[model samples]
Target: MAESTAPPVRITSFGYGHCRGGLRIPRAHLVLDLRTHFRDPHVAPELRHMTARDQEVRDAVLSTPGISELVEATAAAVRAYQAGPTTELVTVAVGCTGGRHRAPTVALAVARALRLAHDWQAVTVIDRDIERSVIAR
Candidate 1:
C-alpha cells in the first residue's frame, strides 16, 4: 500500500510523577493534559486495578462530565493542527496520575476522534508506563 500523506496523530498516555522518557516520538505538537479535567479512576477501589482497555473502565471515564467535550475539542485541535505549518505528524500526550486508567482511555478516545475528524490521517496510541503501543496506521 502507498504511504499516507496526511499527518499522523500519536496519542500517548503518561504518568505525572515519572515522565522522564515517556515519549517515543521525542517531540509533540500538542499535549492534551487530561490530569485535571476528569476524576482519576485510580481512586475508586473497584476500578483501580482495571485498565482503561476494559469496557467498564472506559464507560466510567467517558461518563465524566465534560469528557465528550474534551474529546471533541481534541479533534478540533487536531483539525487546526492539520492546517498549521509544520511536519505533518501531530503528537499528543494525554496524561493522568498513573497512566493506567484515565490516560489510556482518553488517548484512545482522542485517537478515535482524530480518525473521524480526518479520515486520511494516521493514528498511533501508546501507553508509556506499560510500554505498549498500537503501531502506526
Candidate 2:
C-alpha cells in the first residue's frame, strides 16, 4: 500500500483594483479593505485617538461593528473554502488610502487570523503597487 499526499493550499494578497483572472482552477479569493470600514469619521472616539501602530488598532479593527461584520463575512468565505474538496488557493485584497500602512497591516492581520483560525497553508502578502514598481521597466 502507498500513502498519498494532498495538494498544496495557498493564500494570497492583492491591492485595490488589482485582478487575478488568469490563474488556474482550485483557487479561492478573499478581498478586504481597511479604508472601506475605517475611513469614516464616525469610528469610535477611543479608536480615533489611538495611533496606527498601537495594538488598540488591531483590537478596534476587529471590534468595529462594520469591520467585524466584514471579518465574519471573510471567515465564512474561508470556511466554505475549507469545507470544499479541492486543491485550493485564495487571494485576498486589502485596500487603504496608501499601500504603505493600514492596508498591508490589516492584510497581514487577516492572513494571520485565517491561518490560526482555519489552519490554512501558505499565506502570501503582496503589496501590489510595490510589485508593480519593481517590475516596471
Candidate 3:
C-alpha cells in the first residue's frame, strides 16, 4: 500500500449572522461583513430591515475602519499561502443581515477578485445557512 498525497482543501465560507458559531473548519478562515462596504447613509434599505440583533452585528462590522485594507489583506494572504510549500485552501466568510442579498454579493465579489488576482486551483463561496438547508439537508 502507498500513501497518496492530496491537495490541501481550502473551504471558504460566506454567510450571515446566523452562521457565526457554526463555522469550524481546519483551514484558513476569514470572516467579513458586507455592510462594511456601505457608508452609513448609503446602506441599502433591504439591509436596514434586519432584526435588531442582526443590525447590531452589522453595526459592529461597519464600525471597523479601512475595510478595503481588510479585503486586500485577505487576497494577499491567499497569494502568500499559495506561494508556500503546502497546497493551500482559503476560506473567506462574508456576512450581512441575511444570506439573500449583501452576503452573496460580497461573496461573489471576493471570489471574482481572488480569481482575477490569484491563480488559485479552486475557489468556492459557501452561504452556510442557505447552503446547509438547500444542499446539505
Candidate 4:
C-alpha cells in the first residue's frame, strides 16, 4: 500500500445536552446531529444501561427507517476527505441527547465502514462524555 499523506480522521460522539454552555469540537469539519434520527435507547428498560457498543443498542440505532442512508452519507464524506488536502484534518462529530448511547453507536459504525472502505486512511472514534480510550484503526 502506498504511504498516506492524508491526516487522520477524528470522529467524536458527544451529547447535545452535555453542551450546557457550548460544544467544543476540535478541528471539526462536519457535525452530524443525531438527536432526532434514532429512537432513544435510554427509554427502553433493556437498553438503558447499555452503551452503544452493545449488540442490541447498535441494532436499534441502525434499524431506524433511514439510518443506513445517513451512515452511507457519512462514510462517503470521510472517503472524500482522503482526496482533499492532506495537511488538513477531517473531523466528524456525531451528537445526540446523551453521548452514552446513540452518538457512540453511530460514530462507531461510520468509523468501521470508513476503515473498511478506505483501508489506507486512519479513522478513530471517541465518546466525549464517556471519556474512554480512542477506538482507532
Q: Residue by residue across 1-137, what tens digits does model 1's lDDT show? A: 45545667788787664555543333566776667778877677797777887888899999999888999988788778877776667788877766777788888898888776556548999787643431121
State every prediction's TM-score relative to the real structure: 0.81, 0.52, 0.51, 0.83
> Best lDDT goes to which candidate?
4
Worst 10 residues of 1 by lDDT: 128-137
> In candidate 2, which residue ranges exceed 4 Å CA deviation?
1-28, 40-65, 130-137
lDDT of 3 at 123: 69
Regions of candidate 3 where Cα sits further than 4 Å from its true position: 1-16, 20-28, 34-69, 119-121, 130-137
Q: Clashes per prediction?
A: 0, 3, 2, 0
lDDT of 3 by residue, 53-80 (tens): 2545345333446545665676676566
User: Best-fitting candidate, measured by TM-score?
Assistant: 4
Candidate 4 lDDT score at position 42: 76
Worst 10 residues of 4 by lDDT: 128-137
Q: In angstroms, how far off is 130's CA in candidate 1?
A: 4.1
Across 24-123, the per-residue lDDT of candidate 2 in tens digits comes to 2213465555656564221446644343346765555555566655655775676666566875554556655434345554666656666666564456
Question: Residue 33 CA error for candidate 4 (Å)?
Answer: 0.6
Order by lDDT, highest first:
4, 1, 2, 3
